[model samples]
Target: MPREAAPSDPQDLAILVIDEDEIRASIIEEGLREAGHQRVAVLADMRNLLARIEALAPDVIVIDLANPNRDLVEHLSHVSRAVSRPVAMFVDQSDAGVMEAAISAGVSAYVVDGLRKDRVKAILDMAVARFQAYSHLREELESTRRALEDRKLIDRAKAILMKLRGLGEEEAYHLMRRTAMRENRRMGEIARSIVSTANLITGDEE
Candidate 1:
């Protein structure tokens, strides 16, 4: 099923503007307010950025870096990795490598020389869309990984049951299923318990 689109109304979103320069932060703040965003906060200092962000709990983050040094860029990368909020980074200039790094860091929007009040709303919208898409993909990937692990555990459990109980593969699987149903637990949980017990018993025998 197609995921629902993120809310487009700026009024509904809490925005955080991070910039070392007060003027630049004001510019971004003004842009957001003009776009009908009422819940906007600006931070000039970068110290304890993660902590501040945690306290603010903004839905979207706008970072303006006039001339980002290597350390600053790295800090932004860390924020990108740590924070799941939609991020729109505005930079004066950037090289190809830096752009690639920003994308790798999970930045939703990397705008170069695009810091106009009129453009802020559109950029924010784009950022939110990209963030949502990436989030969905990450969730799907994690779920697939977990499902594969569960299948492996179930297979190992089935093998143990077949050997220990002298039961056929189908019978072993049915036994686990019945146990899961009786306990109102997941099949994977039952499978994992069986595998763990079998390993423990085998180790003791040795």
Candidate 2:
């Protein structure tokens, strides 16, 4: 079992190494320490990889494979999808298909035959930067999708209110807003509830 260091800046991020080979794991660990990262853990037994990783909760992950088969690569992909942390994978051989699979698995850095002690820090840095960039894009896309859905729900709710109460669009919107304020809830939430109830009541007609 490896010990963790005290919390520090981003440059000193805690790292997790998943390698069956002890020698290779040591080289990667040494390189990280040389680069100013003091918190590094190496895991050889992968019986419960994801569970162990969750327990450790490292900031980044490094997987070193000497010669991986298709199944092994696919397993790593599953691991990558489970964890949102930055992942750097090092392999001895290169194959276009394998590289593509690794990228699809959310690996930030996929190095082929480039696992040099001198280059570990730079590779880790690049992985972290790429992961952060991708995470930001995902967040923005999700927020935009939510906003569009809210707008649609509000429109549906407004139309229902207008038809039921014989009010104009503006009046319907203001009524929903005032109701939301009085109930201490978001307008979108109120709109969604109204739309759902209206749909349920009209289900038999449809």
Candidate 3:
């Protein structure tokens, strides 16, 4: 844990270390403390780990294992995916299969035979940075997907209006925009409503 002399919130840049080995955990914890991290915790096992992590509200997680088994790797992967926090996993030895599983489970940084007291802070920084970049990318992708879906809805609504009310595409779109602005709702919402009502009136599943 990096510590500053000033008071700090537990949830602010808080770090949680998961390691069964006390010696390794102490080394990492000491490195973080030396680096001025104020809020850091260490757990020895995975028993009720999710509830424990929820209570701690860690910003990032460090998982260290000397010899991880299949069950343990799976369990850690579940934890990695369940929480949105960045995870940095370190192991003394690993295979391609284990590494692939960790990557798929969303481990931000996976290190093998690279854990040292001096390297802890750097690894943590990299983990957090990578996670932030990935999260931003995912958000952008989601926004683009929503925009496409909204466009589809708007076009379908416009088509329905043109067919039912003898309106042109421009007219249908303007009607939707005016209704959206009047009601303080998004254009997508108005378009969806129009499409839904038209479907009901025509009894068409399409």
Ten-residue region with minimum lDDT total, candidate 1: 105-114
Over the stretch 73-121, how does candidate 1's per-residue lDDT look in tens digits? 3354355666544334543243354445445434433322223433444
- Deviation of model 3 at 80, angstroms: 22
Off by over 4 Å in 2: 1-118, 204-206
Cα lDDT of model 2 by residue, 79-154, tens digit = 5566543233543244355445445534433322223433444655543444445557678999898889889999
Cα distance off (Å), candidate 2, residue 196: 0.6
Q: List candidate 3 segments past 4 Å from native.
A: 1-118
* TM-score of model 3 (CA atoms): 0.46
TM-score attained by model 2:
0.45
Candidate 1 — what's its lDDT? 0.62
Question: lDDT ranking from best to worst?
Answer: 2, 1, 3
